[model samples]
Each structure stands twice: as C-alpha cells, then as structure tokens.
Target: MTPNPPAVPRARLPLRAADLRGLSRLGVDAVVGVTDVVEAMHHTIASVPGIVGPAPAGRPSGITGFVYRTVRATTRTVGRGLDALWAAVPFDTTASTPEREAFVAALNGVWGDHLADTGNPLAITVSLRVGGRPYREALATPTGRLLVLVHGLAMNDLQWTRRGHDHGQALARDLGFSPVYLHYNSGRHVSQNGRAFAELLDELVAGWPVPVEELVILGHSLGGLVARSACHLGAARPWMKALSRLVFLGTPHHGAPLERGGRLVDAALGLSPYAAPLARLGKARSAGITDLRFGNLQDADWQHRDRHSQTRDDRAPTPLPAGVATYLVAATKAGRPIGLHGATAGDGLVPLASALGEHRSPALALKVPASHRLVVASANHWDLLDRPEVYRKLRSWLR
Candidate 1:
C-alpha cells in the first residue's frame, strides 16, 4: 500500500491583539464614564451653587502625591507590557471562523464606526468574499453579470447561506451571474457606509477582470438602506451605468418601530431627575442604531442634530433611481388570516408597510410597482433568506 500523505492542519482563529486593546480602551471609557456620573451625583446631592461648580481641593503635596504618582506609573507600565506581550505573539491573520466573524460583525454593528475610527483590530473592512477568500485573491475569472448581496444589521456575509441555501450561490448556478457578498461594519451610520460602498464599488468595477455588463443588488434590512444610499451617492460614477435592478428583503424604508420604542424609553428615563443618569445608559447605543430610528439614508439626516433627541422624521426623500427596476419583499408571521395583527406586526421586526415602502407622503414613497412586490406569509424577517417561496420569487425576478 502507498504511504498516506500527511494530514493538513485545520486552520485556527487568529489571536487578535487588537481585540484586547480595543476591550482595554472600552473598559477605560466605561470607568471614566462611571467616574463622571458619580462625581455629578455627588455634586447634585451637595446642591452646589452656580452653573459652574467650584474646583475641588488641590492635590496632596508630599507622600500622598508620591504614592499616587507611583500607582499611576505602575498602571501605565503594566498596560504597556500587556500590549507588548500581545503584539509579540505570532497570529495567522487569514485564519478566521464563521462564528468569530459573526460575533465581530455584531460587535461592529454596535460599535463598528467607533472601532474603525480608533483603529481597533476588530473593525471589519468592507470587502467582497469569493470561494471563502477575499475577492481580489480568488477571483481570477469574472462573469458579465454581477449580483451583490448585502446583509442586515449585526450580520456577516457568511450568514447569507441559511439552512444550506444561499441566494447568491443559487443565482450564480441558475443564471450564470457572479455573486459577491459585502462584509462591512454595520455600526457606522448608513450614509457613512454608503459613501464607502460607493467608492469601493467604483474601484471594484474599474478593477473587475471581465467587462461588466449588468449589476444587480439584493439587500436585506439595513443593507437595503445602505444600497439606496449608495445609489444616491454613486449617481455620477461610471459603475452606475451597469446597474440594472435593485431588490429589498424586509427593508425598513420608513423606519423601525422597535427603535422608535427605544427612543421613547430613553426620553421617559430623562424626564425624571432620579432617572436622568440612567438615560445615559439608553443613549449608549451605537450611531447605527440611532440611524435606524428614521431609516436615515443621507448625511444631512443626522449631521447637525443630536442623534439621541426625540426629533421628527426630517430625512430628505430619496426616490429610487430613474432607470433601475426596483422590487420589495415583505414578510408576515401569519400564514392564513392575514389580518390587522399580521400586517402590523410585520415579520416581528419590520412592519409590512415599511418593507413595501408604502409611505403616506408621495415624495417618500418608493414607487415599486405591485407586480414587483412580494409578501411571504408565515415567515419572519430572517426567514426571507431560506424560504423556498422567497427563492422562487427571486429566481422569477432575476430570470
């Protein structure tokens, strides 16, 4: 018998030193925040006079100050030592597991922009994935048609394959279209992600190995909002010329009721003097979560205002692109008896009206024709990914 070849080692998730650093920073911020809150509470209890309170007593001059300085120096030294130790460990950068990716995606969805801004190791850079590898490395040949799939909040690109079925792979096999999944930090504002996506798409199109003839986009939830934002921002770019169709899967075009409810809770907490400090806890939600309150798609929607304040829906209406064919898919939990509750409850996350873009204001309405709209009964928001009917509808549209 021939000698057996050596078994290949299974790839392990890389040790990310940045995660430790980011966590350390977050811990520091939390401690500082608590300190500030405690100080404020003490001041409130003391009933200090004037808008600006008097400064506290001066620092200790001798032994106490020396001891304080030594403690501070020791803490700094320990932190630096930990950082150095982590950095020295060799880590395989490319070895990442799906579970880890999902966790990071959720974390990024909550604090992605902040992480990216601070150069945190956990920040996910937006990119296309093909054959379980980065697109640039794996895509040696390209097809004429491209189908780009964008996932919802707190979701990674790997999640597209639900119950062993991925719409992108299905489309690729059935229609001969190339499928590219976007991996991004969902914690950033929709407009910020949109702008980055616009630039990335332009670069991608320019660098494509094959001449791109058509481009189609499928977005789920917040991903749809990001796609819409990209379209608005990329109107003048060359890549816009290749755009042909855009489909939304349970997108909250109008806004999400859950976020609105959260905002109400925050506002209520702030109304009472005793609960005012507790309001800060509510306000700790990421910028991305706040943007969901009004399905904000443009920078102007949030650039000037306080994101946590109970503000009216001031978002400028962004109509669907003139030439592109647009489609909407809404999901309802009820199978039969699709009555008020079924319609209003809306897949438990998004209401049917919002998913269908049925705004009372004509200016804000998406204008997707009735023929282009689909409603999946007995399905929740996430069910849109793997449901057979949803797949059939997608096939019919793209066919």
Candidate 2:
C-alpha cells in the first residue's frame, strides 16, 4: 500500500517561508548585479583617458576580474545553500497580511519580470480575490451581475480599500452586483498580463455559479490599460459576450510623459561613457512600466525591439472595443480649465489629453461620447480611486 504524502505546515501572519527564501535569493542577485556594475565602471574609468573614451566591452582583466567573479560565485553558493535549507523545511503558504501583500506587490512592480523569469516565490500569481482572499473560497453565493475591479501598478487588490472606503464594496452595497478584484503582477508586459487576464475571465464566466447576466470592469491607472489589452485579445472569447461596460480612471490611453522623461534621463546618461554603465540601472525598470511610454497593448509593439531605446510613438492604434459601452475619467490638479497651468494640468502623473484618450492622430484616439467622459478638477491621480465625486459618477454610470 502507498503511504499518504506528508502534511505541509501552515503559518499565520507576517510572511511565508517562501517569501523569505525569495527575498534572500534576490539579495544575492542584487549583490552580484551591483558587483558587475562596479566592475564595469572600474573598467570604463581605467580604459578611458581623461574620462572621455568609448567604453570597453566585457569584464576587467586579472585581480579585479577575479575579485568580481569570486563575489558572484560566493553569492550564488550562499543562495543555493539557502534554497536547499528552505526546501528541507515542510512549510507552505496559507495566509498573508496586508503589509506583506503590499510589500510583495511593490517588489513585483519593480522587479516582477526578473522575479517571474527566475521563478522566485515572491512573484505574484494572477488571481481573483474577494476581501483579500481567494474568491472561490470567499464567494459563498455568486450573483449574476459581476463587478470586476482591477487595481493599478505596484498595487494589490487589498489596496482597493483605501482610507476605510472601497469602491467595490460600495458598489456591491448600492447595487446587487457581486464584486471580484483582480490581483496580478504589474511588472510584466501589458500584453502578457492582458492575455492572462482574458483567459482568466473566460474561466471565470464559464465556471460562475450562476449564469452571468452583466459583466463590468472598472480599472484604475495601469489596470485600465490591462483591461483594454484583454478586451482586444479576447474579442472572440466567450467572456467578451458577457462584458457590458469598460470604465477607465486616469488611464494613460495615449501614453504617460513621466516614463518618457525617464527615457530622456537614460538618453542623457548614455551621452557620457562614465555614465553609460549607470544607464543600465534605469533600463532595469519593468516592461509594464515601459509600456506606459506609448500605451503598448500588443506583443508586436515590443517584440524584437530594444525597449530602452528612445523612439517615437509607434504603437498600433487600438480603439475602444467594439459594441461595448466605454467611459473615461480624468483628474487634474489645476483649479480651472483654461490658462498657463491648464496647459499642463494633469493628475500629477497622467496628462489630461492622454487620460481622455485624445490623440493628434485620429486613428489613435479612443472615441468615447462626450456624455461618457468626466474631468475632475483639483483631483490627483489617486483621488480617482475613492473620491466622493468620482464614486458618484461611477455609481450613476454603473446604475
């Protein structure tokens, strides 16, 4: 007779064993990466005369190279030892705290692509959650009307509840719709997450306890871009049939200048050989963040291209999904609409024209009816999350 498998131990609050192991491994990687950067800097400085020559390729020679190599090897050895030590233990994750979730979410937003590529335990898996727990377990009685809330970059579903107010909960209370939050890694490419999301939605609708009557998605910041990507990719999928409305809050439909500014910094650093190696540090940002530079939604937009290279907006125009009711909401820090301040009035992150999907090229513009668009003055990007005015607009439109 075959014996039953050993039970995996569960722990409450703080963090999981896997989280610590992943972090330790990341620390080792960070050390190795920094050592490489330092070595490159040293080599460039040594090779360049008067600090103005073309940077040489590859690692340094002799003692310096040996020291850098040794550091990396030793770090990897320690990382392997930690991995084995942790593997010897029988603990598995069962629960997570809000703080832990936030930390992991932010880490994913920054190094999520790396974490995922390395199969790090800290990598966040896309999941449908209710009240910060798995929706399947928490959803006791599923309703026909489903309201899906998607959060922005560097954020988890738990962050949907801010300042003791949650937009999903409010909608649930005001209406009969059941709320489900999408939690995913925000460091991957928008297209990748979008494809995953589209598939997840298909599974959700197929397995829903009741026949789904109405499906609405309310996305904030990068969440809106993800939703758009999903809709574009899943046009032929069954979930698209149930999708009734797509609402975007402060979505950078055209692109965000902040990421463009970051690119400018990269370009500036590349001007000097001494600073060229340091430019790699900025280039290390996640693909998702880079996608915001031009609101890239398809893999073709980034595939086989240097993402860090400064280039004009060449994204294929993706208009609002056909036959779906769409709404747009934008925020502005300025007090009024017309003036010098109004010329650049944005939510401190995304510009008004971008958020409103207004583009110089007609093909790129997302044509939403004027009635479906709202611009909230004196409100910043985050204010769109739970602002009273914004909530009212959402309730009215959703109702």
Cα deviation in Å at residue 89, candidate 2?
3.2
| Candidate number achieving the greatest lDDT relative to the actual structure | 2
The C-alpha RMSD of each candidate to the native structure, in angstroms, is: 6.1, 7.7
Model 1, span 327-358: residue lDDT tens:
99999988742689878979898999899998
The candidate 1 region of ten consecutive residues with least summed lDDT is 49-58
- Taken over the whole model, the C-alpha lDDT of each candidate is 0.82, 0.88
For model 1, the stretches where C-alpha displacement exceeds 4 angstroms are 1-15, 48-81
lDDT of 2 by residue, 71-160 (tens): 899989988999988877779767668888889999999888989999999999998999888898999667898989889989999998
TM-score, predicted candidate 2 vs. hidden true structure: 0.94
How far in Å is the alpha carbon of 233 misplaced in model 1?
0.7
User: How displaced is residue 377 in candidate 1, in Å?
Assistant: 1.1
